[model samples]
Target: MRKQMIDSVSKVIAENENTSLFLVDIGVWGFRDVLKNYSERAINCGIFEDGMISIAAGMSLSGITPFIYGISPFILGRAYDQLKLDFCYQKLAGNFITTGAAYDFSKLGYSHYCPEDIELARTMPGLEFIAAGTPKEFEILFNSTWNDGNPTYYRLSNYCNKFDAKVAFGKAAVIKKGSKGVVIAVSTMLDSVIEACGDEDVTILYYTTLVPFDGITLRENLVNEKILLCEPHFEGALLPAIIDSVKDCAVKIKCVGVPRKINRNYGTKIEKDICFGLIDKDIRLEIRKFFNN
Candidate 1:
């Protein structure tokens, strides 16, 4: 997925001579070669995440479509002030390409873990938050934000899978159709929900875009079925939005994601999933419980 994102972005840069890609923390694993191969002007801002965002904002002010690449936590959490003040507040046209969403960086410990950035980004005016669950969706997001002439923040997960891009920019894609209930999975975690409920009597909605949610489609599909929202991040805005959107219906709603507990110690992604009761078995059990209720 990282290679695909780099290739797509590089292709865009190659086609457009006016655009430049600036990477933050290119010294990190999996990105060193991308930094070296791309002919476009790229910069390694060392470990100073906040300074990199500031510089990117300045570049945007000078009429450059700067792509600021970095880890999710560093890009969203470390440089939040710059993101809020310089980019979102100033309304600059910069694309924040953040890798490692949710537990994607669980192996790196709590310091690098980012589980609330999307929800945090929702509060920042003029900042768009996009999460891609599949390679095809990533392609659409890359193209949309890169060419849209607006400020955006994009989050990518290390886990890659094949999915239909029919509902790329809309509210969510209905992966499975059923009359009993509706399971809404957020981006990367959509595959898990499908695996948990194989051949079951339920509908699955894959939400690739967080902001600018498609309310009409969401309302049309969520009627008369129990709603379950599964995500990798902390359940703050996304879950509530689902409930609020379908408030007029007689549907029951629940959210599955990181628990409301601070991390005392960090472990692998699988370990974190187990700790938060988000594994396949647990997910299946939760679905069963939701229906049984």
Candidate 2:
């Protein structure tokens, strides 16, 4: 998925003569490779995440659409002030491409894990948030954001599995059209939701865009069905938004996501799996409970 994102961004740069792609990288594992491959467009700022964000903001102010790439924890967590003040507050045309959403860096330990980036970014006004489940969906969202000229944050996982790119901006896609219930899984966890549904009467709503959420569609499809909102990050922005949006509906809404606890153990992929309840069996159990309740 990382390679695809880089390749897609490169294609966009090559094809769009007016737009220049500037990549800001921290000292993450694959930073050098991205820098080496896209030398002319990519910039290595060492470990200064906050500085990198500010630089991107400046570049955006100068009429260049900048795409800042970094680990989730550092890009969003470490550079919170810069992101809020420089990008969100100033309303720059910059795109934050966050890799390893949720527990993608589970093996790397807790400092490397970022489980609440979505919630954090959603709090800031004027910043658009998107979580893509597949390469195709990401392509659509990435290109659309550039055309839309919005301050956007895109969360991507390291690996790519084939998924339907039939997703629409500001709305969720129904992966499986079922009537038993609806499981609205945020980007990285869409596949798990599909598997957990099994033969049950469950519909999977892959929510790619969060900020300008598809309130019209949510109101249409989530009327009387049992609703479960799943995300890899901690429950905050999206969860509250879902609840508030559908508060008047007769649906039973439940949120499934990472527990709001600072992890003590060295963060690994396994730890992330545990944090988001991504284990197949565990997810299945949760789904069963949601239906039972």
Candidate 3:
């Protein structure tokens, strides 16, 4: 996990001398001591989320590329205006490396939680969203989207666990083949989805990139037009993307994710998962009903 960030950030900065890295007060979790390796271009903006985003925008406008790192909620929710104008409006390029994705920080309460980040980021036009669920996905997508002219958000989780899953940028990977139905698992939720489907004859699709999603492949691979879409995000994060993919078909899609209600529930990630109906049994029930009915 550390190697992915260190190596990828080092390479991006090395290749682009005009780029800089910014951090909020929460750098310890995401960057660690490795950020000092790029001290020359580091901007530790303390806890001023909006200020840091505006400054990064200013820097980008002056022909400099800025890579901002911080918690997901603050980065996307707080500085949304600057993100919309400075980067999106000006058509400038910048990168956001965010942690505490979904409920990864649920124990920290709603202030630290980011269950709606994907839904919020989806509102911004032309922003590419990548959820590098596993370490391997991090290496490939982070490197692929680094230092581009377009704006991108790289949502992350604290889990350093590695998976053998090879995720294409926009295309969905079919982990298993099934004639019964298909399951679309987004990023980190792939593990739980795998466990939930255990030994069941069902097709599973994995996605990293949310925007510009390969809905074409998603539609083509639908065996029964019955999709059990799983995500560790809010209600409509990937719902629209899937809808766009299977618009023409009579696809019956049932999503398994956090509820679309007040998320006042606070606890550890596992507790929050259970509170939000993200357990394996819930997923299995959803899948069973989707395929059976």
Candidate 4:
């Protein structure tokens, strides 16, 4: 997915002269060569995440569309004030493409993890959030919104789902239809949610673009009152949207996602998932509890 993002960045740079790429010395591995080829266009902004965001805001003001790429935790967590003030506060337009979704860098410890990015994004008004679960989806979403002149956040996950719903901006893909209940899978959690669901008579709604959530579709497909929301970020980050979508109905909503707390373990991302009870078996148990109760 990083490769796809780099390729997309290259394509956008080759096509548009006003576009620029900013990195805080993080994406050097995949983007080193590209940076060299377009040194003037792509810059390695060192480890100064807040300064990078301020610079991006300036560039945006000067008719340049900056695509800032960096680790999720630092870019968002470290420079949140810059993001909220420089970008969203000023209504400045730019693209924030981040890696290390949730616990993707689990072995690197808590400093590398960012489970609250979505919640932070939700606080910043006019900032659109798109969490791509696959290389193809990243390509599509990035191409479609790179130059939209809106403060957009693109989350590239290390993990991906096997299926592609040909996702679009601000739209949810209905993967399966059933009368039992509804399981809303956000970003990369679709595969596990599907696997955990097994052969249950339930509807699965896949979400790639989450900010401008397709509540209309969700409202139309509330086959049953039971709803299970599975995401890769902090639990209940997308809950308000669900509640708004089903405002008229008494829906039983359950969330399966990363807990909003510190993770001190070091291992693989899968191990982190196991620790959080976000694996298939645990999610299945949650699903059963949501339905049976």
Candidate 5:
């Protein structure tokens, strides 16, 4: 997936003279060779995450398409003030390419963990927050949003494409059809949701983009009103929006995800999944609870 994103972005930068890439000590090994191979186009901004956002914003204002790249926590979480003030405040467009979704690199400890990153991003305006669960979806997101006029976030998760489905960023895709209820899986949680619902009769909606969530697709899913939100991030990240979407309709909804409190849990992401009730059994339990109610 990283190769796909890098290759696509590199090709774009090579072709477009006005576009530039800003790197901040992340994915150096993955992209250093390819980007440095571009020479003048890629700027190794070092450890200054906030500074990079400002630089990207300034460049964007100057008619140069600047893309900020690096670790998820630093690029988005650390440089949030700059993001809010520079790009979002000015309503300028800059590409934010982030690696490591949530706990993709859990060995770095909880400080690097970012289940709440979207919670912070959700407060900002005019930013498109996207979590790509599959390689094809990642490629589509890059292709669709590369030079768009909105501040876009491309969160690269550890999970790849598990099943074949049409690729659309903000719009939800119904991978499986059912009549009992609907299971809305966010980002890479698609696999877990699939396994959990194998024995049950439920429709699975795979949503990639967080902001600018496709309301039209959502309305289509309203036929099966009961929704069980399955996400890898903190619970309630999408609850507010989900509630707002179905305000005029009668719908039963429940969100199953990590808690708002920081995860002091240890070991790998899967272990953390067990710690936070994101395992398949827990999700199945939640599904039963939501439908049986």
Candidate 6:
């Protein structure tokens, strides 16, 4: 997936003279060698995330399209003020691509854990968020929205769904149709959601774009008043959208995601998943409980 982004962005930089790439120490390794050919446009900005956002905003003001790449927590969480004031508040356009979705770096502890990235991003008005579940999805979303002149957040994960469904900007794909309830899976949670819902009478919706929540398709495919939201990030991230979309109807929503609490443990992501009840068996149990109600 990193290769796909690097290759695609390299092509964009080579062709478009107004485009530039900024790396925040994390992407320096993979991007350093490729950026050698375009030394003037691409640069490693070290670990100054807040400063980097300001630089990208300035570049945007100068008519240069800046693509900033870094780890999830540092890029989004650490420099959030810069992102809000420089890019979002100023209405400037840039692409903020992040690696390490949620707890992908669980072994490294809470410094690298960022389950609230989506929640923070959605607060900034007009910002688009895309959680790419596969390399193909990232390539497609990047190509479609990179030059759209909106501040877009692309969350890349070390763990991705095995299959690549057709994805688009602000659109949800219906993976299955049923009459029991609706299961909306976001990014890396799709595979687990599918495995948990095997043969269940539920409609599955694969959601890649988080910010511009595709509620239209969700409303149109309502099989029941029950909704199960499977998100890779913090729980209730999509609750507002869910309620707004089904405003005319009375709906019941059950969310399975990272708990809204501080996690002090350090281990693999799977261990965290077990602790948070995000595993397939636990998800299945939750689904059954939801249905029984």
TM-scores of the models, in the order given: 0.90, 0.87, 0.92, 0.97, 0.94, 0.97
Among all windows of ten consecutive residues in candidate 1, which has the lowest summed lDDT? 25-34
Task: State the lDDT at 197 in candidate 4.
Answer: 92
Model 4, 149-212: lDDT tens per residue? 8899999887888867678898898888988889999999988998999988899999999888
Alpha-carbon local distance difference test for all models: 0.76, 0.74, 0.80, 0.89, 0.81, 0.89
Task: Superpose all Cα atoms of candidate 6 onto the true structure and report the RMSD in Å to 1 decimal.
Answer: 1.1
Q: List the residue pairs that clash in candidate 4.
A: none
The digit string of per-residue lDDT tens for model 6 on 122-215 reads: 8888889999889999999999999999899999898888999889988999999999999999999988999999889999999999889999
lDDT of 1 at 101: 83
Query: What TM value does model 3 have?
Result: 0.92
What is the total number of backbone clashes in candidate 6? 0
Query: Which stretches in model 3 have alpha-carbon errors above 4 Å?
Result: 28-38, 160-162
Predicted structure 1: lDDT: 0.76
lDDT score of residue 196 within candidate 2: 77
* Off by more than 4 A, model 6: none
Q: Which stretches of candidate 4 lie over 4 Å from their true place?
A: none
Model 1 residue 136 CA deviation (Å) reads 2.7
Candidate 6, run of 10 with poorest lDDT? 25-34
lDDT of 3 by residue, 1-293 (tens): 54576568767776777888887866554455446666777657689988888888888888888988888889899998888887888888899888888777776777877778878777888888988777778888887776668889988887532475877677677888888888988888888888889877789988888876888778778887788889888865788878888888897778888887667877688887887778778788777777876
lDDT of 4: 0.89
Worst 10 residues of 5 by lDDT: 158-167
List candidate 5 segments past 4 Å from native: none
